[model samples]
Target: MKKNDIIITYGTHISKMVRMVLDKAELALSIPKNARIGIKPNLVVAKTHDSGATTSPLMVEALIQYLQEHGFYDIIILEGSWIGDDTKRAFSISGIEKVAEKYKVPLLDTKDDTYCKIQAGPIEMEISKTALDLDFIITMPVLKGHCQTKITGALKNFKGCLSDKEKRHFHTLGLHRPIAYLNTVLHPGFILMDGLCGDLDFEEGGNPVPMNRIVAGLDPVLIDSYVASAMGYEPDEIDYIKMAAELGVGSMDLEHANLMVLEKDTCPVKTIRSRKVQALAKAVTEKNACSACYANLIQALARLEERGLLSYYKKHPVCIGQTFRDQSGNSLGIGSCTCRFIHSVPGCPPATADILKGLLTGLNTK
Candidate 1:
């Protein structure tokens, strides 16, 4: 498929949908027979594919079957879940382990893999050696909402290839620039997006909205730009996408993209989910917060909102992020950086449940 070509197929049969798109795109023709291929999927959390936090194992299996059928056997599945989550557990719970076992393909958990320092543009980060060893990468990221970046797609999925330390560092570097730079270093040859169902607001995936389709493309920036527009935002709203385009990663010009839809009259009109995160974020006073920490706080606030307890934070406006370091505060703080705060739930990036518990306890005392 050409770099500017994007193919879409719609159906409930994920395996058939994947095979149809791959075949039509002629993705196999682009790879050499002896190439070491890595299938990177979004196992960001230990949730089933139905939960909308992960890529479908059925889709992965279909890709594997298609590759093997196309005489491509040097294939492996590799991924690392977000920090505070176990990759092994995610693989198992997400049904990807069984798919690997059935196909007799190796599953490399990048969390346990060694790293190599790579420099891209002005940013340098440690990427997994196993990921770097691959001749080509097929990124399968779930199209989802991100609390921090507003959206997550092809470019954001590459964060899984970074060491856990580098992942944290990316967040500290404000996420956007580092993410854009990471793609400049490790660009995937092909992208197959899981548009089946993705969480509407948070990356961790609790509230799912079903949009039964699969999107295939060669350009991450272009695909992400399309994703941003489809998800009710302008391409420029996502900083990394625009930065990656500027850094020569890929074009964000969707107008020139050759979009082809296979299935007839099945492309659902994109609908915008309520911006609950925007409303909930009013209670937060954040500065350079990491994705994980910010996500946990958002989920916690969502839970509080459900219980009609979110109002307790209007006056408090919970503080979080690196800038809170060495600063004393009277308001509730969410992470270890705000240790000087009178009320603090302390972890470098505290768990959602723990954040909720802390908020509940504070509410009771008040």
Candidate 2:
């Protein structure tokens, strides 16, 4: 599908923007009008009103109305919040339960099912048995800023579709790998973002920003790329989006994008969630800058960052491995006769000069 026609409509009354964004990309299809359809939304947390946190019920209602007008009304609004918060409770609180009643559809919370975990490569994800059993699925996500990934688009929203364990386990692979893998396996037939001025810095619990934009597309990766650009972030800054591009899940590059900026004034958004991180390769010659010393230094820095001691380290990937005069952590260490304490290190340590250079350049541009 060439551009898949991503629609980025503006304004706050979300449903209007949602309908405008989705009207063309997801056409009035004739595929079993009364099919058992599932509309997956980002009910990640329970918040009052739209608040630009989760998918607005009005946005889903708008889609339901669209489908109904097209003679397809049988559908189920399904979701399961991975966090301990009750998905059913969240649905009811978020106004989705009332939408289900009005639409005459079921609000199925997948957490209630006796599910089985399937090994998708080295990772196991808890998927909804009932949703998977559906004939049609529609991925409806609220476009927002993510702590790890710059923007949480349709793909990240799908992570909620899996069981709770799978969602938490993703942190094991550092948050990006498992996300990329999961997106490759399952994708929505159509993606409609409930953006219309969504989040920018944080997704569920952070203050909201008015992105006044609702985008829809077939390619989850491409949709994310658009959301990132709209948010003024370098698409490549988000590793998950990059991973999706590398896996051919979808393209992050917008040059080949057949995007239709519907009713947008082309506002330039800020590129946040980026910072400076670097590691130096030190030879055994210097003790002050040795591997252990660097470890302690980095550990202190990381601890400080974690406690909000340093705000600059947020969302920045640590780039390391330039050769220093210390050998405790060098590429294929020639003299490794000391320092028995070690946790995890990449196979090859990058040179100190390279790491510093990259960091300097990255920070200067920002």
Candidate 3:
């Protein structure tokens, strides 16, 4: 596969799939044999791959085996799970630790790695020192929906390389522009996406839709653009993908991309958009609500849907953020920014459980 091209191989035999793509792309010839390679995979939460929230261990193992075969031994598996989750726990739960042990490759938890400030375009963010020192970075991100960004792929996975403080700061910076800026500075050389089974609605994953395929590519922006299309969305729907393209990260123009399919597509693309999420989002009046706070609310609504309780508040809107500062009355509110509201759940970003409880009680009262 060429830089602008994407290859999709169908099946669960991850190792074989990895080998096929590497040979097809002749990716080894592009990198220095003795280069220090860093492999970053998404293990955002302490959950198994079956939960559709993390990268598959089999894929990572296959990548390690392929790289080792090509004489690349100075490889490290690195990741920093999202702020509130433990990276160690994610490694254990996602079964990546066993793969690391078998390959004799050290696992570097970026959560514990020291970071140094780096300027990427107009943005200056702290990135992991070890990540900065790598000769080549191979990104392995799960293709999944995101509450804030609409979707998370190759570019979004780089957030793991930042310190926990910087991760939070990205949210404060409104996520999209900062993400685009970060990629300008910290670009991954290659991307092998874990697309076997991914959640359709949330980044943290619960609903696993088995697509039974692995996607490989070199262009991060193009890869995300293709993923956005497969997941029933245009690339422009994801703000960062468009922003990154404008910043010259890569092209978001799928029409110009060289898309290659190695095997027949077993799982045809379906509209994975959840109606419950749509309805709940319609009830949300947000103005700069942070990703965590907004995601917690979405998760809470998902839980309510599971319990068949979503219909109760179908017509009720939830007010959040600084814009609703002195707002009150019938609408339920979330976060400390909505303190003046009578039914606000108080926290800078309320806990998921608390958000759930607030939804149940606040909506019931009305």
TM-score of each: 0.74, 0.69, 0.74
Which tens-of-lDDT digit does each residue in 1-366 have in candidate 2? 344557655555567666776665655562455677789988888764446578878888898988888888778888888576889888988898898899898888877765557666567777778766777778888767677665788778877777777677887678788888787767677787776545544677444544455677788888887766555455797888898788878878676778676663223222212232132111112222223223222323332433453333233433222332232431222112222212122222222222333334434544
If the candidates were sorted by their lDDT against the true structure, best first, what order would they fall in?
1, 3, 2
Please, what are the lDDT tens digits per residue for candidate 3 over residues 1-366?
577899877665678887887777777887776899999999999999877789999999988998998889999999999998999999998999999999999999998999999998887899999999999999999987787887789999999999999999999999999999989988787898998776666789876555566888999999998777655466898899999999999998888888777764323223334454456566677776654456456656766666687766667678866677776655778888788787788875565567788888875776
For each candidate, how many residue pairs have backbone atoms clashing (under 3 Å)?
0, 22, 0
Clashes of 3: 0
**TM-score result, candidate 3:** 0.74
Among these predictions, the greatest lDDT belongs to 1
In model 3, state the lDDT of residue 59. 90
After superposition on all C-alphas, the RMSD of every candidate to the true structure, in Å, is 14.6, 14.5, 13.9
